[model samples]
Every structure is written in C-alpha cells, then in structure tokens.
Target: MAFTLGSLVLLCGISGLLTGVWSATIVPVKGNNCPKGWTQLDCYCYIYEDERRTFADAENVCNILGGNLVSIHSDLENALVLELSEAGGVAPGGGIWIGLTDAVSEDDFMWTDGSNVDFTNFSGGEAGDDDGDCVAMVTDTGEWVDDICAIPLPYVCIRETFRH
Candidate 1:
C-alpha cells in the first residue's frame, strides 16, 4: 500500500512539473503573437475585417503587420476565405480585393509570394480581363474577377509567422 501511494505521489509531482513548463512555454501571449482583432490559423494569422483600400495600399498595411493581402491557391484556402467572410459579416455587395493579379500581362496572374498561380476559384466566365489585370473576391458571388488593382476596395490581409 505504501509503495502504491509513493508511486501515485511521484506521478502527480511529475505531472505538475510538466504542466508548469507547458503553461510557461506553450501558452500564447495575448496580442503579441497574434494582433488584436485577428485569429491564428495554422502558422498564419488572418484579419477578416473589410477595409476599403487599393491592392497596393492593402499590401502596405499587411506589410506593416508583417503580413500581406490574402491569397487563395487551394480548396483549403478558398474555404478559409469563405469562413472569414462569414465571420466579418461581409454581405454580398462589392468584391473584396485579393492578392492576385496579372498586371504584368494578361493570363499571367501571379501571387505576391513570387509563386505562379496554381489554383483558380473564379466565377464562371469571369476574370475575362475586360478592364484590368487584378483579381477581387466577390462577397455575393464568392468568386474571383479580374479588376483594376489600383481601385480601392475592401480586402482581407494575411499575416505570416515570424518564429524567434
């Protein structure tokens, strides 16, 4: 009976020590690791607010926050944008500017990350480049369309991680 009690005490002490270490190292620092009005998704942080700004201006804002305008490249990314849209209470009015454009040329859409465009979630027959070489996310239609990148519009920003 004494041996069992000693074993239980030893286990409890080890668990308490581990819990202390975890709380000190693993617990996130409020507003430091993640900024105010932002949420952590994977290794990135995202702000779902709707802000009216040009694509370049949006990029600047994101840069100031150690991030960039949102760029969608896969089904998972698409779903994440849809989720953010819903969370931000954005309605179907105007399209939100994303970090995609073919401003260099037609059919040459590229991401700001210097990566080639691999995924496209544009609406049917949209992104026809009738006007500009930029892409925007339509809230109502939930699709991408080529537009003037310089035009000011609501946009979502993506914050990258900086591990120290």
Candidate 2:
C-alpha cells in the first residue's frame, strides 16, 4: 500500500508537468487589443458597419488602423457587404459607399489601393460618365452605383494584419 501511494503521487506530478509544457508550447499567444468596433476573421480584423465620411476621410481612418476601405472583388465579398448592411440596421433610404470610383478619369473605376476593377457589379450598366464616378452600395437594390466620392456617405473599412 505504501509503494502504490508513492507511485501514484509520482505519476500525478509527471502528468501535471506534461500538461504545463504542452500548454506553454502548443497554444498560440494573442497580442494587443483589436481595433474598436472590429471583429477578428482568421488573423485579421474587420469592421463591416457603415461609417459616414468622405472617401478621403474613410481612407485615412482605415490607414490609421493598418487597413483600407472595403474593396469588393468577388460575389462572396458582395454577399458579405449585403449581410453587414442589413445587420447594421441602416435606414432603407441610406446607402453605403464602397471603395471604388473612376475619379481618376471616366469609365475607369478603380479601388483606392490602385487595383484594376476586374469585377463590375454595378446594377445600372457600366459606371462613370454622366455624373457617375464614385461608387455607393444600395442595400435595397443590392447594387453598386457611381456617385460623387466627395459626398459624405457611409462607407465600409477593411483592416488586415501585416504578416512578417
């Protein structure tokens, strides 16, 4: 009985040591607090809520948080934007501005990141020309439209972590 008791204690100590080592080495450490009104997606954080600001101001805010204005390039991204707009409880009359415009010229809509607009998800034909250079999202219609980027419109910002 004495020998058994000693062995049990030894085994317990070993198990505790192993658990500590595993926890210390296997678990990844999370650093810093996430940006305000943002949620983590994978290793990056995102804010899907609509914010009222000019295009330049929106870009500045996103850059301060190490990100850029939301740029939709795929159907999945477009669907996500729709979901966020609905969830934000924005009034039916309000529209969300996206990070797309042909302000550089006409009929040459591009993202603020300087990427070519490969996907044109506009509802009313191609954007630009005839008072349509900026892009805004209409939740009621689920389409993008060209508008004036200088206008103070609600916009979406995207923040991605820099992996080094």
Candidate 3:
C-alpha cells in the first residue's frame, strides 16, 4: 500500500506520543545569554517584576521587554519562581501572576507563551471553582491558585536568553 504524506505525519505524531518525545518549553539562546538582571536557567532567562499589575497589564509589560509572562514547566522552575518572588520582596502569602490562564476556554488552562501544558502544580481544588481565569502563585507557599484576572499582582517574565 502506498503511504500518503498525511499518513506519514500522523504516524510520526503517534510515534512521538508513544515514545514520550515531547516539545520543550525553553527556547535555546545563543551568544550574549541572559542580561545582567535576568536569571538564567538552562536556555531560558527569567526576571521578576516587583510592581503589581493586572494580568493583562503584566503580559503587556513582558511583551515590551521581549518576553511573555513566565510559564512553569516543572517543580524546579516553580521553586525558582517562588524564590524569585521572595527575593523580589513579595509580601507573605502575596500572589504573583503566572502565564497560565483559562480565559479563552474556561477550565482549560494554557501558557501565554504557547508552551504545552505538560505539568501543573496547582493547590488542591484549584484551576476550578470559577475563580476567574488567571493563575497566581502564592509567594509564601509556592502553591498556585486560579484568581481574577483583574487583580493586581507582581509577576515574572521569561524569554530565550538574549543573543548577540
């Protein structure tokens, strides 16, 4: 039987899934690497903004800085984010906006940077209960909760480390 291109692509997709060959969230950087104030992790760079702003406003700020709101893909990243928040002087139990949100389709969270939703560390019963659409990490506990998008909070931004 002759194999069509579509069938070949489908087979490759299924094979990748079965083999656990998924895409990576970190964007590889070259040359210059992260700026002086940004923290580098693997190939991605992150920066914590202490000023509080609404979710949309925070994202807009990140866009201006050449990145999007930070997306946590693993426990290590989450911990680092928590540490960053603390280092940035977030108040006890204060929240920091992350990139996860379900605004487009309620209860269906996605990263603002278009990364796959492969990992999550929400607190118990979170990402639900109609708590608006945005997500914020409780700085003191590193636990995540869905919250109102309009609420002002500090946030982190992530981007590929700068290049020459």
Task: Identify the runs in model 1 with alpha carbons over 4 angstroms from their true place.
Answer: 1-33, 162-164
Instruction: Give each model's whole-structure lDDT.
Output: 0.74, 0.71, 0.89
Instruction: Spell out the clash pairs found in candidate 3.
Output: none
State the lDDT of candidate 3 residue by residue for 1-164, as single tens digits.
Answer: 34785586667778778989844333447555887799998889999999899999999999999999999999899999999999999988999999999999888889999999888888884565866799999987899898999999999999997665
Residue 85's C-alpha lDDT in candidate 1?
Answer: 78
Q: In lDDT terms, which candidate is top? A: 3
User: What ordering of candidates by TM-score runs from best to worst?
Assistant: 3, 1, 2
Question: What does candidate 2's lDDT look like per residue over 88-134, in tens digits?
Answer: 88666567878787778777667886666777678766553557567
Off by over 4 Å in 3: 1-32
**TM-scores vs. true structure, each candidate:** 0.72, 0.68, 0.78
**Residues 83-138 of candidate 1: C-alpha lDDT, one tens digit per residue:** 77767777765677778877787887788656567788888854674687778888
Better of 1 and 2 by lDDT: 1
Off by over 4 Å in 2: 1-36, 39-44, 162-164
Decoy 3 TM-score against native: 0.78
